[model samples]
Target: MKLTCIAVDDEPLALGLVCSFIEQTPFLELKGRSSSAVEALKLLNDEVIDVIFLDIQMPDLNGIELARVLDARASKPRIVFTTAYNQFALEGYKVDALDYLLKPFNYEEFLRAAQKALNYKELINKPAVAEAKSEDEYLFIKVEYQLVRVALSDILYIEGLKDYVKIWLASAPKPLLSLTSLKALEERLPARRFMRVHRSFIVSLDQINSVTRNTLHIGDINISVGEQYKDAFNGFISKWN
Candidate 1:
């Protein structure tokens, strides 16, 4: 089913970017765009919106405040907060936001977030249908204007930039870039095959060429295990050895 969506950002450029991204996705329909939270409120009252791409910082009523207002309603749309700041993430989750997307996000990341929101809605609205399905073994990621199908087996590792995740592949020389978080990618990957070795890296266990002390080698690439992830990485290594 196609999800009805809306964009709300004080900046015209941000709103336009979101609208453009929504237009590219076949499963998402852009219901409307608003420059402020107040305008969004009026649209919400009249329309049957499934998801909302919201900007955290706005004049008069901010996105978070607007989310609080929406939360009071019996039928509130799933929220995806778009912002330049990462500090508001905790608050975003507190309000039950589906995902927190940083500003300057690409279409691939936007698609991932939108998919997650739709999936969540499906689970809530139809639990039996959601439960009967097997885990997703592949993902279709948008790269530039093209949609690229990525099998989970082909991934070597993933690295997180400020607002983007780079998916390193075993066969491809260049990594696939998507506007997404390492945390989000980790959740999507199978726990038995992928493990977080560092704050910025998630490695495919099948791609490991060698491991020495705190570093792991995936072919010619070397990934270090961060202090926070050291114990878990060591445990995985110990179990495999």
Candidate 2:
């Protein structure tokens, strides 16, 4: 299937080049092009865009902010960030971008990024098999530039540090670090298997060694329950008592 996209960049030349690349690509269909993030948001709302060829550094809203806005929506396009700077690449992971184009990149690099978006579309669009598991047993999180697949059963707990999170696992001594928000990961995790007992911690229900009035023990790690999430934790506690 052809993945529909909108080219977004503040520079006229950059915009034209991306639009041109979109047109040349066999599987990508260019639905629109915008020089501003605000205008791009409007166009995105009006159409069912599959992907966005977005430039990260822009005037006004900027690409990263625009990506977060779209992330809030029920349906949002996969982002392929286009930027001249390597420094801003990590920010792209916070929004779960599919791929990114480093500036002064050749058509080959752009085509590779487009192909990645198309593969993602195909994966999501594939029809579910009758025997397909109802719940996902694993999660693939973006770690820097690569997607790291972690098994749900292996995760002991998670630690949040605003823009990044650390996944503590049973298999490894070191925790896996990823560029994403705790709230974002919380939404994706299975409710029955995981719970956010603290603002900074999410514990695997099966991995809990013990729970007390304010603290939870997972192995030797003592995680304090946050006041904001007390009621939910209490509900889980009540299930056992």
Candidate 3:
């Protein structure tokens, strides 16, 4: 699929380099170029873009802020951050960017990042052809007063409080906290992809890195498997082993 992109960078040379790379790539089409975030906003309003090649550091509004603004819209294009700064990588993920490309990056790296954006675009646009199982393979949760759709594949783990569930996603920084019972959530999730390792936690099987007798490592978080759930957990471990 072809991707229509806009390049936004304060530096003229950086902007030119992105344009050159887009010109060389067959699947990418450079739709617009902006030296500032304000100009980029205008361009986005005028045209239909699939992805944005954004630079973190700009004169006035930065790329991160632009992403936030875009995210507030009904339909927003995917973002691929292209910047000289490495410190913003975490922040880039916080905004659900497709990928982060450091400045002076080679064609191969650019292609790889661009491909990720293309893949995400396809996933979003394609119809859900798979039949809905008795248990949910995904969730639609409210975040910032909007119902955000998240696939089971994107979830790392679910942390439960008394009357709330905090969803830790693979792509974002803050967990999405909602007023939902862990018991209610467990009933909705697919048994194959999710397992209740703890009374307070339900983790995605694909996101599990390792497990000890008591704890399962999901990314940087260490979650304890409750004693009550040990029987089922052991059964799951046996299957994988």
TM-score of each: 0.54, 0.67, 0.63
Q: How accurate is candidate 1 locally (lDDT)?
A: 0.86
User: For candidate 2, lDDT tens digit of each residue in 1-241?
Assistant: 8999999999999999999999999998999999999999889889999999999889999999999999999988999999998888777876889887899888999998888787677766666762145236878777764556689999999999967899999999999998878998999999999999888899999999998779889999999999998898888898998
> C-alpha displacement of 33 in model 2, angstroms?
3.9
For residue 93, give model 3's deviation from the true position in Å. Answer: 0.6
Which segments of model 1 are wrong by more than 4 Å?
Answer: 127-241
Candidate 3 versus truth, CA RMSD in Å, comes to: 9.2
User: Compared with the true structure, what per-residue lDDT tens digits does model 3 show for residues 119-204?
Assistant: 66665666555434412656766443224578788899999998578999998898998666789888878898899988789999
Please write out the lDDT profile of model 1 over residues 1-241, one tens digit for every residue. 7899999999999999999999999999999999999999999989999999999999999999999999999999989999999999877866778788898899989999989877766655666645335245666554532346688789999999997789988778999987668898888788988999899999999899899989999988899999999888888888776
Top candidate by lDDT: 2
Question: How well does candidate 3 score on lDDT at residue 231?
Answer: 91
Any runs in candidate 2 off by more than 4 Å, and if so which? 10-13, 34-47, 57-74, 90-96, 128-136, 140-148, 171-174, 179-188, 195-199, 208-241
lDDT of each: 0.86, 0.88, 0.84
Task: Give the Cα-based TM-score of candidate 2 against the true structure.
Answer: 0.67
Worst 10 residues of 3 by lDDT: 128-137
